[model samples]
Target: MSSETHEFKAEVAALLNLVTNSLYTNSEIFLRELISNAADALDKARFQALVDTSLDGQELESQILITVDKQAGTLTIEDTGIGMTREETAQNLGTIAHSGTLRYLEEMQRARAAGESSGAVEPNLIGQFGVGFYSAFMVADEVVVTTLSGKPGSEAVVWRSRGDGSYQVEPGSRSQRGTTIVLTLKTEAKEFLDRWRIEALVKRYSNYVMHPIRLRVIDEQGEDKDPEPRQINAASAIWARSSSELEDSDYTEFYKHVMGGFVMPGDEPFARLHFTADAPIQFHALLFVPGRAPADLFQEDRKALQLYARRVLVVENCDTLLPQYLRFVRGVVDSQDLPLNVSREMLQEHKSLAAIRRQLTRKTLKLLAELAEESADKYAKMWNEFGSVIKEGLHTDGGQRAELTELLRYRHVADTDDGLVSLKDYVAGMGEDQKYIWYVAGPNEAALRNSPHLEAVRAKGEDVLLMSDPVDEWVLQSLSEYEGKSFRSVTQGELDEPAEDEDIDDKDDDSDDKDDEAKAKDKREPSPIDPLLNLAKVVLGDRVRDVRASKRLTESPSCLVDAAGGLSRNMERILRMAQPGTKLGASPRILELNPDHPFVTAASKISETNKDDPRLAEWVEILHDIAALAEGTVPDPAGAAKRFTKVLNNLVAG
Candidate 1:
C-alpha cells in the first residue's frame, strides 16, 4: 500500500527529542508506558462493548500479549482492545493534544541548559501532557503500530516512525479489531529482550493492571517452542476479592503494587482495611496505613490512592479519593457504579464519588479505632509516626472532629515516660471540680513543661496536655470542646478557679446575699500587690491589655496571657512565620503577676512609696521582658540584653 508521509507537530518533535534523549532516567519505564496504554485501550473497548453490543472487539479475549524476538532485536506488545483508523492514528501519534506541551518543552529545555541530567518537570507530566506514547522512542530506534478500529466496516492502518522528525501512515490488513506495536530495540536497550527483565518490569509497574498480560519469548534461533503465551500478571483485581478470602501477605503485596514500588521494603503495613460496599453505591476498597509515611507525604500534590472503574485502572494517583490530611493512605478503590468514562472534572462534582470518599474516611477512622482498642502498643507507634497528620483533620474536617479528637493522643505534665494520653483518659482522670480541659502549646515539650501557664494546674495535681506540634494550636481552635468539656488553652484564658474541698462545704446564705454596700466595701480594699500591678500597667501602657494579680502563677514573677479573644503567643508565632512582613501584634495581651512572689512584694513596696522612681519603671520593663522570654520568644533581644546589663551594673555598684 502507498504510504502518506507527515512531519510531526513542532511540540511533538520537541517531545520526541526529549524522550529519545534524556526525559526519563529509568529507561525500562518505556515498557510500562506501553503496557499502560494497552491496558487503557482494552478498558475503552470493554466499556464501549457495554454501550454497543455490536462493537467488533467484544468477541476477543480482554488481554495484552508480549512477544520478544532476541534474534531480530525486536519486541512486540499486542492488545485485543480498541484501535484507531488511519486518520485517528495520524492525529493521535503525530500531534500533541495537551495545551501545556509548549510550556513543558520550555521547562525541559531550561533544565537541560542548566546542566540538569533529568528533566525538571514532574515525571507524571509526561503522561498528563499526552506524550507518554513517545516514551517508546526512548528505547527503540524504530516503532511500527498496526491497528484496526473496533467500529464495524473500519479499515486497518499502519503507523511507522523512527527517532526522527517524520512518520508514515498507510493502509494495513488485520482481521482482529485491536492494535499491535513492534519496537526495533536500540543496541543499548537490548537488555529489555531478556525474558527475566521483561517479567520483572511487568510485575513492578503493571502487576495490577486488571488485564491479563501474556508473554512469549523467542530463543536465540528465533523459534517459539511454546504453543501458547504464558500469563505474567495475576490478572485478578485484589481489592475486589472478599476480605475473608485474602491474607496479610496478599494485602501487603497489593499495597506494594499500588504504591508503585517497594516502599519500606522491610516493613509490613501498619494497618489495612479491605471491604466491599454494596448499599448506597457498589464499590470495593483496600486501604492501607503505610508502615511509615512516604518520603513525599507532605508534598502538596502527592496522591495516595488509585481509583478504578469496573476493575479497570482509571486514575493512577487519585488524590480526590482521600482528604489531603489523609494522604498517608495507600490503596485502590474500584466501583462499577461510576461512569466508565468519568473525567477528573466529573469526579469533582460526582455525588457517588463524594459518597465513596466520605465512606472511605469513616471506615479508615473506624479501622484506627479498632486497632487502638485491640492493640495499644501498635496504635501508639502508628500515632507517633502519623499523629501530626491526623491532627490536621481536626482543623480541616469539622464533621469528623469528634472522631479525630478520639484519635488524638498527647504527652502531658504527668507523663513519666514518653507515652501519650487520649482525651478520654484525661477527662476520666480530671478532678471533680476541674471545669476545663487544659492544654499548653510551645516550641517543645521542654518549653511547654516549663511554662508558667501550667504552674497552677500542676499545683492542683491536674495534668495539662503538652502541645508542641505547629498544627496543635489550630486543632485546639477547631476542637473547642470535647465531651462537653471546653478546651481551654492555659496560656490564652483565665486559669481555673481553685477546686473546692468537699470537707469544707459549710456556707451561710446571709454571706451570699450580702448588700451592695458590703460588696462596694470589699471592692474598695486594695491588696498588697495592687500597687505593683497598677504601676506595671502604666509603665507598659498599651503593650499590655491589663495587669492583674495571678490566680494561675504559683512561682513565676509574671506571665503573659492572650486577652479575652486574642491570639496566643504560640498562635502568633505560627502566623508571623507563615506570613512575613504583616502586622500581627496589634492586639496586646494581659500580664499577670504572682501576688505572693518575693519580687512582686518588694516591687509593690517601692511603687507604693515612690511611684515615680525610675528604677521601678526599669523593673517593670524587666518584668515584661522576662515574661516574653518565658513565652519562648524575646520581643527585642538587644533591648532585653541592654536592660539586663544595666541591672547587673546597678547591683554591682550597690
Candidate 2:
C-alpha cells in the first residue's frame, strides 16, 4: 500500500511532550486510557446506528480486541467504533480540535507550568482535549492507526507517528469499518505483553467499561495458532445491581475501587447508601460515609466525584454530585439519562444533575439518621470523625438545614463526658418551665462543660448543650428555634424562672408592713459591689457595649456575650482566621459581672477605699483580659501578661 507523509502538527509535538513528560501519574493508565478511548468511539458508533439504519446490522460486534506480539514488541487495540474519516483523522489525531479543546489545553498548560501535569481536565472535555490518545505514545516508540469510516462508500485512512516530530496518512486496505491502533512498544513497556498483566489492568480500571474487552491469546505450544478470545473485564455496572444480590464486602470493595484504594479510616464504611432512581433522573449512586474523615477532607482541594454518564466514566472525582459539605462521601454516581457529551458547565446547571444531588443528599442524611438509631457505636465513630463537616451543611445548604440539624449530636451538661445527645433528646428532657433551648459555644468540651455561663442553668436542673465545633456558631445563625422553642445562648440576654402564683399570695399578707421597711433599706443601700458596674462602664465605655450585673455567673467574676444580632465570639474568631487582614469590626461584647463573687467584692472594697486610685481602671482592663482568656481568646497578650503580674504582686504584697 502506498502512503503519503505529512509533518506533525505543532500542537501534536506539545501534546506528545506533555504525555511523555508526565501528564499521568501511573504509566499503566496509558492502556486504560487507550482502551477507554476505544470504548467511547464504539459508543458513538452504536448510538449513530440508532438513527441511521444504513450504518448498522453489518458491522462487527461492538467490542474491543487487543492483541500482543512479544517478539515484534507490538500491541494492537481495535474497536468497531464510529471510525474517523481522513479529515477527522488528521484533526483529532494531529491537533486538539474539538469543542473546548483549546480551553482544556490552556488549563493543562497552566497546570503543567505549575509542575502539576496530573491536574484535572474538565470531565466533559475528555475527548475534546484530544490528549488521552497521546497517552499511548508514553509507552510506544511508534503508533499506527488504520480507520474505515462507518459511512457507506467511504475510503479507509491510516495514520502513523513514530513518537517523533512527524506522521503520515495514506489510503489503506481495510474491509472493516472501525479503528485499529498498533503500538510498537518500547523495551521498558514489554511487561504489558504479559496476558495476566493486561487482564489485571483491565480489571482494575475498565472492569465496569460498558462494552466487552476481549484479549487474543497465543498458546505456548503454537504461536501461529490463536486461542479463543477471552473477556478480560466484568463489563457490568455494579451500582445497577439489586441490593439483595450485593453484600457488604461487595460495597466495600467497590468503595475502595472508586476512591482510588482509600481504605476507610476504620477499615469500614460508616454507612452505604445504594439505590437506583428513575424519576427526575435515570441514575444510581453508591455513596459511602467513610468511617473516618481523610486528612484532606477539610481542604478546598480534592479529586472530583466519580461522575459517570451511562456506564462511561465522565470524571473520576466529581464535586457536583453533592455540595462541599458532603465531600467526605466516597463513591460513584452513574446517570443513564445524561447525554454523553455533557459539558462541565452544562453539568453544573443540569436539571437531572440537580435532581440527583437532591436525592443523594436526602438519602445520605436518612442513612446517617438510621445508623444513629440502629447502630449507635458506628454512628458515634462517624460523629467523632465527621460531625464538624456535617455541621457545615447547617450554614451552607439551607434546604437541608432541618435534616442536618436532626443529625447533629453534642455533649450535654447532663450526659456523661463521652456521651452525646441529639436535639430531640434535649427537648424530651426539658421541663414545662423551660421555654428555650440553651447552649454555650467554647473552644473545647472541657471549657464548655466548666463554663461560668452554665452555672445558672445547672442550678435550675436544666441541661445546656455543649458546642465546641467551629461550625456550631454558624449553625445557630439560622437555626434559632426548633419545635417552637428558641435556641438561646446561655450567657446572652437574661434568664428568669416563672413566678409562682401561690408563693406570691402567701408572701403578700406577711410582707405589707415589712416590705415598706425592706424597700426603704434597699433604696438607701444597694449591694456594696453594685457601684462597680457603673464604675467599670465609665472606664471601659466603648470597649464593651454594656457592663451589667450577672444573671448567670456564679463562680466566675465576669464573662462576655454577643450583643443582639451580633456575631458570637467563636464565630467572629473563625471568620477572622479564615480571612487575613479582614477586621472583625465588632461592636463591644456585653460584659457582665457577678457582684456576689469574692473577687468582685474585694475589688469593689479596694476601689471604695481608694476612690481616686487609677488601679480601679487597671482592674477593669485585667478583668476583661481574664474573661477573654477564660473564653479561650487572647485579648492582648503583652498587656495581659503585664496586668497579670501587677495584680498578682499587689495581692501578694497586701
Query: Which digits, one per residue and each the tens of the lDDT, describe model 2 over residues 1-654?
Result: 467777776656775676665666567767876787787677667655765679833557989999977767788899998787787787778763342234434775796799866443323223444567777887899999999888887888999998777789999887788889999988899888888898888875677887899998554443833577878887888898999998878887788876667674556877888899989777878888876677778676776568766455656667888888888888888876664432222354557777888898888889988999998878888999989888988888898888898998988889865788889989999999887788888678888887778888888899999888878887887787789778877865546522211133334554553363344334443556766777898988888877767768878888886654356777777788788698766557878788878878877887777756788888888778877877777768998899999988988999
Candidate 1: where is the Cα deviation over 4 Å?
Answer: 1-64, 68-75, 78-205, 209-212, 216-231, 258-260, 263-267, 342-349, 496-525, 612-614, 642-654
Q: Tens-digit lDDT track for model 1 on 1-654?
A: 588998888756776787656655567767877877787677667765765688896779989999999989999999998788677787777775442323434665686788863422232112234556777888899999999989888999999999688999998988899999999999999999998999988875667677899999898897994559999987787787788888877777778776766767556778889889987888899888888767788887776688765554556687888887788888888875664321221254578888899999999999999988898888998988889999999878989888888999999989868788999999999999888888888777887888888888888998899899999988877777778787777886455422111122333334441242244335444667888888888899988877877878999999988753456777887998888889876467888888888877888899889999888998889888988898677778999999999999988999
Query: TM-score of model 1 relative to the true fold?
Result: 0.69
Clashing pairs in 2: 304-317, 304-318, 305-317, 305-318
Instruction: Judge candidate 1 against the unseen true structure and give its global Cα lDDT, from 0 to 1.
Output: 0.78
lDDT of 2 at 481: 79
Worst 10 residues of 1 by lDDT: 497-506
lDDT of each: 0.78, 0.76
Pairs with steric clashes in candidate 1:
none
Candidate 2, residue 78: the lDDT equals: 93
